[model samples]
Target: MNTVPWLTILLIVPAAGAVVVAALPRRHATLAKQLTLAITLAVLVLAVLATFAYDPDKAGFQFGQSYDWISTFGISYSVGADGISLVLMLLAALLVPVVVLSSWDEVDGGGAGGGRIPAPTATPDATGGTPGGSAGGPGPAGDVGEIGAAGEIGGVGGVGGIGGVGGGSGGTAVALAAPAPAPARPATVPPVETRGEAETHGRRSVPAFFALLLALEAGMIGVFAATDVFLFYVFFEAMLIPMYFLIGSYGPVTEQAQRSYAAVKFLVYSLLGGLLMLAAVIGLYVVSADNLGHGTFDFATLRQMEITPGVQKLLFLGFFVAFAIKAPLFPFHTWLPDAGAQSPTGGAVLLVGVLDKVGTFGLIRYCIPLFPDAADYFAPMVLGLAVVGIFYGALLAIGQRDMKRLVAYTSLAHFGFIALGLFAFTSQAGTGAVLYMVNHGLSTGLLFLVVGFLVTRRGTRDVGAYGGLAKVTPVLAGVFLIAGLSSLALPGTNSFVSEFLVLVGTFTANKPLAIVATCGIVLAAVYVLYLYQRTMTGPVVHEENRVLHDLGLREKIVVAPMVALIVALGVYPKPLLDIIRPTVTATYADIGKSDPAPTHPAAAHPGAAHPGAAHPGAAHPGATHPVATQPGGHS
Candidate 1:
């Protein structure tokens, strides 16, 4: 009944901003970037205000607004925020601005006056020569013994000269031989002046990139705030367009073909999942019609429907598969590595840090609450898959060479933990799962941003490419270590609290699985420390690494808040837990489940008075009088 339409405004601001930014002249690229950052910041402020307005004591969705959109079909334009949705909305808003700041230099042509700046190439060594050369001249050329070899000589050595023996006059021999053959330009390549235009011709414009980012922000907010099932689906699919372009056209990879392949793979997997979910959505509508005498896609109404277990199982598979694919759990996780590795840094932050969370959110929001019976039936199988993903992702992460892919795999493992908590059917576990989602976004987002900073300097993702980076970029190394430690759920970090809660809750229900999952913690430490040791420690072997600069002003600005939050939340989690716990309890209550009670061996003895038992005649352990429950009093 809230009249402000807070969720709608949240959706419109960014969506409207995307259109305006996209329509700007190409020369206004800097304006576009600045404007996009401002808009995201505004959204963050609004999200915070909304959180302040939300009442944790409330039992239902807040800031809710609804209107019948398709009366005949029972669909509505509805939106609201619950505790889970509010936190996630805040998370998405928080990261988008950080991503923009981190990507200031990564996006091509974001310079002043919106002019196209050429992408950073390998740094020239001292004496004004490429890294390939030892001295100031061109790299050493291939030896030519005969006239035929001379033709090959022209193409052998790098810029400066062909068959250059050293820094001496020999470096210029190839240049004088044949004028360097005009560098043998590709037939399809455009002239230098027009190359930027060509790259931006179809879908690679700088304005488009910023526009897509804003649009993506809108979509992410919409997904979390939406209350109508069909409306959720719309936002779910709409976000993919921007992500596709972000991955394919604007990725950091130099090879357009590789970016395109990764983009296509991501698109294909998502579309398949979407198709399955679409069928399930329609199935829900049909089932609703059969029961209620009309079809409806209203989530609240749908949750109230009494679904038969058999049909619930069918619908559950459809939704579960789609969400699992989104979660990219184990077998369906192949697309993520390529996509994450190929995406632009800002895009990657949103990809793993926010977008991938939709799957787990859907499981909590729709799969469990709407189909509680089916969820209970399938909990065991899902838990097994989650456990498998934990180890599978951890093992793969330990073996990855690409830093981006390694981070992506770590997310897969973390998702397993989130999934396990959700299925554990306890309030503590569910609350921890929700908290885990937020912490993962903060910690992993920091990890991705830091990696992007490193890649910006080193120009490579290979772990072996770096050694003793801490020697030169000590601040950067320090930040990277903190991020890695957080990822491994180190004590006194935010992840450790949520992770601990998950294990403790799971142990109460399923001891063996909880114990097995504990091993993933060790594996997390192994991969995280191994990554840190390989990249930041040891002797500085590469000369390029020696010159690497530490984090600059902007980079520090990007990381400061994240680090503060990670540490702050680790120390005092009571605020977030207070907000999240009530919803988790309500959700379990709706499912007709309660926390499992603990038992002691003494309870098995006959005629034994339990110390904590309430009875009319039971004597207090230390008090002078016997304790008793009043008549008609509830336990």
Candidate 2:
């Protein structure tokens, strides 16, 4: 079944895992978690195979499977993977397993983190992960939280219960107890986790927690994989439910009011956006029916319809506002900070890393392609707002004391950059924007995981509470620094390449805007380095931080893939770029734009006698706009 419908299986596997986890008893919470993790990792395997199996040289929508769901209305269970969707699907699949492993101790509390191990100051604490595949012992990262300490603060969570479980009315549901022992470690190494010290710890609703996480994973994959316009909308709105529950029921209970408010705010904003899109959907159907004698919501079919610029503009706004809310651009970004504060770390990782991408993805996949005129009309306005968001988000992030909220705001900045690359409409810019999505997911997800570790160990997400952390938890400090560098688009990191392409692309389109946006990069470095300096570099004045342990084996495993990708993509990004270029070329064709030629300093002046004779105004003379290919053949 190599030729089987892999995209459908990619969707169904996590869904099946969620159902299985839901069916299991709370007493089997450990087993349910293990099973769910295995299924997610297995999906990762599938994604890797799909990537290799794909013939990157020739691209369109590969692995396409369309079937009639509503024959009368022209909607169907249509799904496919192109270079663009494939990378995102891989991102969604990759993160679930890492989040599972990183939060393993928090959820199950199988052992005391630092009670059995020597502190980093006393001796090297190698109780956890090595650099790569192994979640080796918390090697020099430090001896973090002591046994029986409160882990990540719960707006809706508690030390005594896993799911804050309630005994069921029908007979009696099984109550979750202790975390099961992890798989046996090599005998040469000392037992870093002292289970006896952590026997009283861990959450009680393990089965329920895994079920919710798996459900969210499934929704994310479906959103990226759906090809039909109607199917895409269904997945778009459906992904929000698990997130709502995760925030409302899984955060620190002390901040229950804040968590509840955040959840409600998120729900209200998302619902408002969804309703607008729903109205636009009906309008599209009606318009298509009048023009083509049948109602249709096929993305390809709608692209071919000769809708008037007026109608296209109206439909575009409905979709754009929804996407903008999802993107959480400057004026629309107020809801994100609250939600980030209240969400569980894993939930936050998925929220900022993957779910937010759906908005930008919608812009690339639907809004622009289907409404080229509207997209062109709005390009200047959108680009203007995007530049505003970049500066606005950076300034706010620099001023924030809360770690989670700071990370959330940075995402706003990154999304603004992605939006800029897209509206510039150059192939280089488009390719870079798509690559930015994948790289941003890796770097930001790592930052959240590290912050989660700090919050759980210290009972605070406030930056003011931390000082001289690098002296205590060196490895964590290092990880945080790397993430910061990536955030600020430091040279030799994944983000720099994408950001460079965006600047180059924007310059050809709008010189003044490009110059303005470039200043945002300077602001990015300011916030990133300032946050690091305040938290990790000062004297270790706090008594509680002195004993903090470095990364454990489990935590190392969580970061290895992310670290590898950051460097891997930085050095050679061809694999992902190859996958992204074909679809980007197609997008350009849909919008009627040409790849602007590269300009060199010597050849840039209009009167200069150079081979390219490059003019700042248009495509190079006598040369075809290489729409479906890269400059040097493969980026």
Clashes of each: 1, 41
Q: Assess candidate 2 and give its lDDT.
A: 0.75
Question: All candidates: CA RMSD in angstroms?
Answer: 9.9, 10.2
Instruction: Write model 1 residue lDDT over 535-614, tens digit each, in one string.
Output: 99999988867776788888889899999999988888877776776677677777776666536555334444753222
Model 2 regions more than 4 Å off? 108-204, 597-625, 629-635
Q: In model 1, what are the clashing residue pairs, if there are any?
A: 141-163
lDDT for each candidate structure = 0.77, 0.75
Residue 381's lDDT in candidate 2:
93
Mark the 10 consecutive residues where model 1 has the least summed lDDT. Answer: 626-635
User: What is residue 138's positional error in candidate 1, in angstroms?
Assistant: 22
Q: What's each prediction's TM-score?
A: 0.82, 0.83
